[model samples]
Target chain A: MYRALKTKPWISLLAFAAPALVFYVIFLLIPTLGGVYYSFTDWNGLFRSYHFVGFSNYVEAFTEDSRFIYSLFYTLKYVLAIVILQNVIGLGLAVLVESRMRTKALFRTLFFMPNMFSVYISTLMWTFIFSTAFPQLAEKTLLHFLDQPWLGSSSMAFVSILLVSVWQGAGYLMVIYIAALQGVPRDLQEAATIDGATPFRKFLHITLPMIMPAITICAFLTLNGSFKIFEVVYALTGGGPGYSTEVIAFNIYQEGFARDMRYGYATAKAMILFLIILVITVTQVAVLKKKEVEA
Target chain B: MRKRSLIPSSLIVLLLIIVTIFFMFPIVLAVVNSLKSQGEMFKSVIAWPKALQWENYKYVLTEVHILRSLYNTFIITILSIVGIIFCGALAGYKLSRTPGKVSAFIFFLFLSSMLIPFYSIMFSLIQVASGLHIQGSVYRLPLIYIGLGVNFAIFLYHGFVKSIPRELEESAQMDGCGQLKTFTRIIFPLLLPITMTIVILDILWVWNDFMLPLIMITDYKSYTLVLLASTFFSEYSTEWSYILSILVLTSLPVILVYLVFQKYIVQGIADGAIKG
Candidate 1:
């Protein structure tokens, strides 16, 4: 039995890996490769027969398709704002909630309530707040800014989507940051306090570095998540104001399934999105990991 | 010194209270307005309704098949969680135990796709699912979720299995048990903590997932709660009373789960994020 196990260890490994591997390969791996392959074809998603179109689909996305280009930039802009805002707000809330001696759990639960609901549910709730409650509140009071066309107008729609995204997502990162904060030793803070450091100075020199790993994770999450944001945009604005709020994922969804059904072209756009996320994430992690080590 | 610090402490407390209000605004507004009549809501959005509008909730519950949608969501969430945990634990255990070239390669293959965005694969995923005739069926969606979700769960389980001692499993095998039997009896029960983490994360994920069902499920009869609520929103766009009632109903389950499992859910999210 020992000799048999030694001679064919792969048999056991194969047995263990087979179930997951089978499902993964069929649903995830095959479609991924198929997506890459079809990006080079002119398949319109209906007909099985198609011709290889080289890089023309990619070329059109960058050059001729202005909506795709616009959506790319729009998504990038949204991602930048979300990454910065989500992390900063998340860390802020974490620090505040952590510092409190009482009401900490209450605040944490309240903040995290939105995170429990689905993104669409969160957005839908916010939509009513923006469209209905805000207007009424504004009319009753002097808060004129509240009465602006939130999901209807251009600038407000962006603000509305950003608000909802940050509101839903920040609490999640706060939980992460809170975990990291708890991991930081009390001795370090006491040491810093004894060294005549102010609270801000301690947070800057001690607390921040101690929690760099969580920050890195939060940044990575926000970057990856905000880039692929669809449900929020889809549920809230539906890429309205004539696609002003259209992120790359929403644009791809529109091109492939909703509007044109241009599977190959849509695949090309999806590839671009995948590559962007890959490159950006790689650089971000590499840089952040270095910071983590240095700290 | 205490007197001097009081001002700063009060300021911080004030800021926190304001932030809490901001966070709770939507939920409070939704619930409050949901109980108001249409005329009452239009008159004073802030005021409590003079009379409760059970009719709004009644209409949504009875007419829109909200219960059916909730049942569908429950089915999809449970099945996907079961599928992910079972497949992932098996693969993760084996991969971690066996440290050969084949194991490393397969593990690496699973981990490498972690960077591939879901949108990148979504278009082609639809094609593959349709070809397999699993697109419209609610029952089959969990199978696809298992495929998509197993890698992360495997990664989690693989790391977790490391912390568990191997001697227990070996001793179990030394006795009369077969490999699968030993794993089922010895290893899996020991993996309960990580399993809890995985279950919590995936329940939150598969339950809340919108894009997958939106693309895969075309039939109205099979709509998940979120999709159902969303379609209801669009169809009855101006019916705020009905919409708010449905929205409140839709968010109730998750909120209840959160209230019940708040500690574990929070820990599981942090655990999953940090580990992954």
Candidate 2:
């Protein structure tokens, strides 16, 4: 046995891979496969038995389920907003903060401070600000426009969710953009400056091109995260104002856990989300990667 | 030119400071209001409490058993971290060292699975967990975390191990150390830096994670810090003092961890995001 093990390298790989593979399979792999399988079933999650429904669940999710379609559109809208805004704001902050000589680390820490809190916690805190503090500020100060029903109306709740997400998430992307910005050669920027390029010109020509890779990563990360947004909507508006703020994940969650134990149906919706995210992120990454090479 | 630039630069600094306050508004507000009576908080959400109402915190701690929930969170986070590092390092190191069709295929398997969102598998995961009789137990939950978490950790370690020279491990093996011994004794120690990176990233992921814990843990006693705070907030939505205090308590550990390991956490995040 020992001699055979020594000769066969597969044995060694098997030994090392087993521990992780066992857990991965049990927790991640099996469930992933099982989720796809169940997506075709009519399992109510009560009985051991389930019948194969064969794409009806997917059909129901798309055609019959208006809420699902609404949420899909809403989530796409959110993903678009986040992908654009978070990257822009994050890149802006990163550039601004990196220009500081003495206070770079301090500002980075302050910006990233919100990221340390759970998304749930951050959203809850913002709920108070929107629900209570905003009204107070609007009442007593010049910020009267803040007195809108931040979480009580559909449009307002959408804006409220967007604000909280960007507030919590921009800092994270900022950190990434800073790291990427530091990679751009200092001499190149100095040369551009010596050629009488303004700071904005230098940034646009030299700095932005250099950080394209980071931009791609940030865009993908933001895309993935915003598509999977649950905590913020759950905490702030609870997808209320008549489910107007319901994103795909929240809708799936409601189906499986809250509304009914429609495990198979929820799994189908989840699979749709997975496919959407996979296709979009892959396409975005591929396109951005080509940009990186060109730059 | 110098005079003109000075105005813009100072203006930029002033703008940043203002934005900084806007960023910190929720946290500062939460902390300030947590220390006030409900009546005092009602009078002015922005004002410093007339007197520090320690009872708000005391009530959360005593009545809500915040410490117990903190313990549960720590137990899950730490154990999961330990498991992830060990399993990830072992698998990553071995996978890196031994390159062939099998290893390549296994690595690809992990890499592809990274694209599978948690929600997709969550419903089925619950079924599997209940079937395995591991659901609703705090201790057993981290085992699932290790499974869910090890992929990224492995991805990190697999990349990191390529940087270490193979000669050191070969020399250790020549010294009569078995593969496992060579890994634990010789290879593992060299993995400290990347290990620290993985540890910090996973701590942040596991500790601050809300969805998985909310799904796996059903019993009140087993609720993680985020779950507990969320449940409490929903139940006591009107109790601002109590809710704010619990929010502060829930967030304090991660904030402390961030402040203490600012450099590593930041570096880890950058590295993890770019590489993984």
Candidate 3:
């Protein structure tokens, strides 16, 4: 029977995984290796001749690169703001819909609607609302104070991106949290209520604890997405107002293709960004998994 | 205590209303602006149109080759979805069943790519793409779509496949069905919900994708809807009525699909991102 067992699990696994494996290796893994290799050389994106200059790319990017630091700081600011706002508002919307309310589906659709639009187009739509419609409305409504150069001003541009990001994302996150809220077992809520638990107390004791896993997931997504944001910022402002809105992705994009070629250096900056994200994502996922267990 | 709780509730309501108003602002403005004529647009941006210009949408649909662009988007999106579902489901099926370090390692590599900011290697990928002899033709978009899409598809497929019992697959194999047949006949049907999720998610994404189409496909006539709309904005940035109409037209396909796969999308999103 043992000799008759001619099946090979490894071969089957290899066969099963081949399509994804081949595509991944060609498109993703190959490019990643190419990135690491090119980071050492000063290859003009369009040129053929290249000489390796090890560690120089990374060293210069860290110490001599002013825009790199600015990009880092700018991205961190956007990440901090978007990470908090997207989650708070999303969680709020989720809790509201979970309250056995009327028009739940309607609200869900309205909220989730923006995620369906392409971010670039959504940014364009917001650009109209900001530069055209909002200003257009500011003339008639008593809310004359609402109009401004939302995409133009260096300061207010932050708020403009933040508003669009939250509008586009919060609803999707709300739907995510809504699912977790439903899974919370109504009996626990009822038990807390029977024990003379106030709404706040019951929520603090039962609801919050139970939804920590959802919170972790939402926070992770928001954080991951916000730091690497490019499309919305590109569409909304194009990192204008003296490039004050420039984040790391846009900066890398400009260095790579949007302007004069710096493919090697651009890849270096990209690598740093990747390492930073990889570290944070791993740490957050690990810590959150632990908290999910402990809670 | 009850009053304090009520206060927080009202505060949350206020916050939500403010956010909702901001969220709905663009859609409302698009609808109203799409109703206005060119004269109406410049005369008073806030003023109501004397008569609705329903012709704006008609113009976008017919003259702009909005229908053609929609066909192109539909082709790319559907192909990408089929590719994603096949490769994702196949890899997911084996990875979940086979308990091995190699399989687990491959899964982690795929998952980690999701974290790497796409911009990191996006330029190089485009270079490789453009270097391909057929890259200039409309052929390259599907390759790009598959390249970017598989990461998330694998994520969704892996999660759902784990929940499916492996005994079902083993039992089917005992009856002498080939792996491919077992997949199509047995596992594939069982994966309907997750398939729905992958299809809808991919549709929603690839249909609306603009930046890729913008950079990769230089041929103006062969553009996707989102790319067409963006280029339209770039050329006639001041054409408020036309732009608004195009926006409405562009959003329809996605909203239609969303209506059909409503539960799958909402639930899959929850399972994939929110619930972990």
Provide the global lDDT of candidate 3 against the true structure. Answer: 0.80
lDDT per residue as tens, model 1, B139-251: 98899999999999999999988998889977876676678888899999999989999999899899999999988999988999999988899999977888989989988
The interface root mean square deviation of candidate 3 comes to 3.0
Give the 10-residue window scoring lowest on summed lDDT in candidate 3 chain B: B1-10
For each candidate, report what fraction of the true interface contacts it reproduces: 0.76, 0.71, 0.56
Best-first order by TM-score:
2, 1, 3
lDDT (CA) per prediction: 0.88, 0.89, 0.80
Query: For residue B118, what is the lDDT in candidate 2?
Result: 90
Per-candidate TM equals 0.97, 0.97, 0.93
Per-residue CA lDDT of candidate 1, range A22-70, in tens? Answer: 9999999999999999999888867778899999999999989999999
lDDT of 2 by residue, A28-48 (tens): 999999999999999886677
TM-score for the A chain of candidate 2: 0.97
How well is each residue in A124-157 modelled by candidate 3, as lDDT tens digits? 8888888877776777777788778887798999
Q: Residue A114 in model 2: shift from native, Å?
A: 0.3
Expressed as tens digits, the lDDT of each residue in B204-240 for candidate 3 is 7788776677767777767888888888888878787
Candidate 2: residue A194 lDDT (0-100): 75
